[model samples]
Target: MSPDLYTVIKQICEEKQIPEESVVSTVELALAAAYRKDFADKLQNIHVTLDAQTGNFRVFDMKLVLENVSARIKEEALKLARQKKKAALYMPEFHDHDDEKFNADGVDLNDDDKLIEEGKVLLKFNPRTQITISDAKKIYPDIKVGDEYKEELEVPGDFGRMAAQTAKQVIIQRIREAERSIVFNTYKNREGEMVSGVVQRVEGSVVIIDIGRVNAILPYREQMAGDEYRIGGRLKLVIARVEMTPKGPEVIVSRTHRDLVSKLFELEVPELESGTVEIKAVAREAGSRSKIAVVANEENIDPIGSCVGQRGARVNAVIDELHGEKIDIIEWSANDEKFIASALSPAKVDSVEILDRDERRAKVTVKAEQQSLAIGKGGQNVRLAAKLTLWKIDIVQSETNAVIEISDDEPGDDTENVSQ
Candidate 1:
């Protein structure tokens, strides 16, 4: 009778969230290995069947009967026999003969004559590899060569310590493999989607997040600027990618990704979720500022108004998720000039001229009073606008209908050329 393992199998299935069938199969395989180790030689074809409900198992040894044994089987049997002989020679009982007849190295003068005789019989036929037709008749009266025979073997109620340790290793390996599969399937589907998790711990510059099913890695570069990552703090991040490593599946998540803003908007705005509104592009500096271009597919929908919600409720919620980051929701345009004009928002533009279309350079004319706003603090606004529009922008000041070209090539130093 086998030990009752039904309770242990049930507990493993529940705790690991693995299917009962998978757990049972793993346990069966481990038990088979343990039985082979404890009751049969390595070369024996041993199989074990387990009754999952009762936890009782039976073992069988299968062998093939051949009239003439194959060379491969003959070689393998001889190799096994030699290994067993070498092990037996090292035993104390084998060395118990008179020490006077042996040299200092424990080599007996008479053992040399015995070894010469034993080597000749080393390659003799082994019963485990092949049973003669004459011997098969003793076990089964009608048995013939080329027939397979299976013998049920009696096993001890408990496995030895070594066999038990082998079973434990097999079980642990199977569980790890199952866990890796589960994590890969779970996180692979969630790529490019938002996920909620808690800060589990920090290692060096990487933060490990507990995302319900598995732990995700948030590298230092992916962390939000100036955000505190205290243990147990809740975070909403985007799944940047899912990778399979030798150790296991690794989920790479990001809080600094621009798609994080898009995902947050999807969560906050019904239009985005319903496919009525689509995001064309997003330029973000995480924990600081972001600009998104949106267009409405339905004529009845006002994409900007929908995103802003009634009295800025929707945008505020998204902003709060990002830790008070500034967002500019602008209407996307098919016309490059109109899009560029809209991209430089919160500042009134007099006109926009395409300086070099092939080079993607543009010149914007703003009122002298609005020049500082267009250029923004440390040119951050203009830089973000340029990035969002995918254009090289040069802000020119207009005073008294006269344009003064300002070159932004030298950062932090404004070089102006007067033009009429």
Candidate 2:
């Protein structure tokens, strides 16, 4: 009996979010495989078609016509016939009678060659697999060689349990393949963007988040150091990358990427979105502190004030999202000396001089008391300042008696004093 495929197609389309045409094609292919396996001969090429609207189905057998059998076709048919002959020769009934003779080897070589010749003749004259021009004319007066003929076959009353199982497996496999394609296209476009999701589960140190239709993985290395990953908690994540794997597409998300701060700022601040204030650069140590440089294109608008918002509300919102990660907003300047001085914020600088223009190196002088603040704890401030300004900074402390020079590469304890 014909199955009600229309309802099944609609259901699959809605559940899988796949196109109706794709589901219909998948069903047709599954039905064709089931029909061929259960009812058709091995050599018969069969096709199955289903009516999408009415749930009717039909099957066809394809046959090739040839003028004279080609050498390749003859060889293939001979090979198949020999395989069958070998199987029949090893049967118990035949083996019992000729066991000794056949086991002796090299006996009646002519008989073997005769058997091969008979098999070739039988295959060459077989009309179902191959037909000659004269034979074709009897069936179709205007038939030509090298043409294909298709014959419709009666639809089977029922496909057995095994065939039903095979069809179901095919449908499932096709659906998985379609799902992979959809997911790949969906997330591939979302790379380098921020998305919101709920924490689905935790596997060891990795956290899985349900971002709408697909799950994204946030590896331990990409997670914020102090953030708690509880199930059902909501998180805003950056889509670091999307990769295709043998199982399916994998989405890699991040919370500690430096760009995450930039994206968050873009989300909160409208001036950055409208391109009034441009973020020149961003330097971050995730879960700790970050420095961002912004320049205002309009003279009346203040870049720092806009990002900071009324009473520090906008920047504070971003800080709250980052779990109290400290952020320093600096005004960008084209002058290397001015920009370098501002990049080291909260630390008063006495002066900044360009040491090497070609090498992009600068010497910054600060008061002796501000040396520790300029260098920061573990030299993080100088490191981020250098990255934000794209310059190598050498901090020189101005004291009453001597000058102490400290390079960012050197440890905080390693300070060299220059005699006046």
Candidate 3:
């Protein structure tokens, strides 16, 4: 190999953000595979090492040092080998996990030489890979069982056209595998955090966004109402899930997640990170409205005011990010009654009567004029308040003594309230 080969390997490592050791190991494996593809018939412990400075290859045929093998253990191995043949014809789902670990002949992996079962050592005899301790002492003076014994082999120059193509395919396959691992780990740690992305395209109901290293999928359900996903448009999304699929890493992002509200606040308000003010709970209806409850650790600091910023600059920044969605920032109280009343903001509550403490149900009586405000446009206010407090709320009119209905999920819901 020319010295320029090292320069090419360095360029690949820098571009892919992969470690130098990993890339060099991949090259060595490729060389060993190419040599085996043309010459070797059976599996052998082939180890290939590349010199970084000179770009040279050194090949070795390695064997495991085994103490002994019993005839019973050998019979068990033969039985299992027959079972594998039966599986190829009939049983398809007999094995689920990958056989990569068990295939240690040419594949470099971490495992002991012997298979130990129930305090007994089970050894499978393979003359090609394993050597007996008494026979091994003839070749070497001091060699212990369970240790590896290696003999240097000549590096072959010429493999057929097919074998050379196989080596190229292996390099490409391993590079792709390494990239998938890097992208999956990088975004999995950022779950529930906001990320900046550009709209790549809309595939039916799902919108794909280019987020730095990878593309994130924003499903139709996660997209906010009235939100436009034009191509090349910029967006701020929260990572909801990161999973590996047969193809590659799947990053699911959301605009309608409740955490988006609190995450946005953390960006605009520096106090949230200081331990001075803390956000207690967030209940969001995504595009239309959101309710956030916050508490102050110190008596001198006002949590809601701190979030609202000077003349509402802080909260306004969050609202702009949400595409002008309305926000209700209320002070969190330890008392359930006071907290429940506060959750239904812009609605004056005359009294809060805990109907069933065990059930976490409450009856809130508001002034006759404030009833409409409390119920919002078709009970949206009461519904969001219910979600924020995690309590079932009933809106009652102080004057008419009539109970109003509410729905927890549906918007514009006018269901009747049974509570008195």
- RMSD, one per candidate, in order: 11.6, 10.6, 7.6
Which candidate number maximizes TM-score?
A: 3
Cα lDDT tens digits for candidate 1, 1-420: 345688888888889988888787777667767776667653455556788878888776555565644455446445644454111101123221211122324333234344334442222344433455665677787877777655677878789899899889988999889878987998899898899999999999999999888899999989887788899999999898999999899999999887888889999998999989988878777888888889999898899999999999999999998989999989888788898889889888989999998887888899989888887776767766776777788788776544433333434211121110
**Model 3: which residue pairs collide?**
405-415, 405-416, 405-417
Q: Which order, best to worst by lDDT? A: 3, 2, 1
Write the residue-wise lDDT of candidate 3 on 300-398 in tens digits. Answer: 998999999999999999999899999999988889999989999989999999888887788999998999999888577899888777788888999
lDDT of each: 0.73, 0.75, 0.76
Candidate 2 positional error at 355, Å = 4.0
Candidate numbers, best TM-score first, in rank order? 3, 2, 1
Model 3, runs deviating above 4 Å: 41-43, 70-123, 405-420
Clashes of 3: 3
Model 1 spans with C-alpha error above 4 angstroms: 1-4, 45-49, 58-158, 201-208, 243-249, 353-363, 394-420
Clashes of each: 0, 0, 3
TM-score for each candidate, following the candidate numbering: 0.70, 0.75, 0.83
How displaced is residue 182 in candidate 3, in Å? 0.8
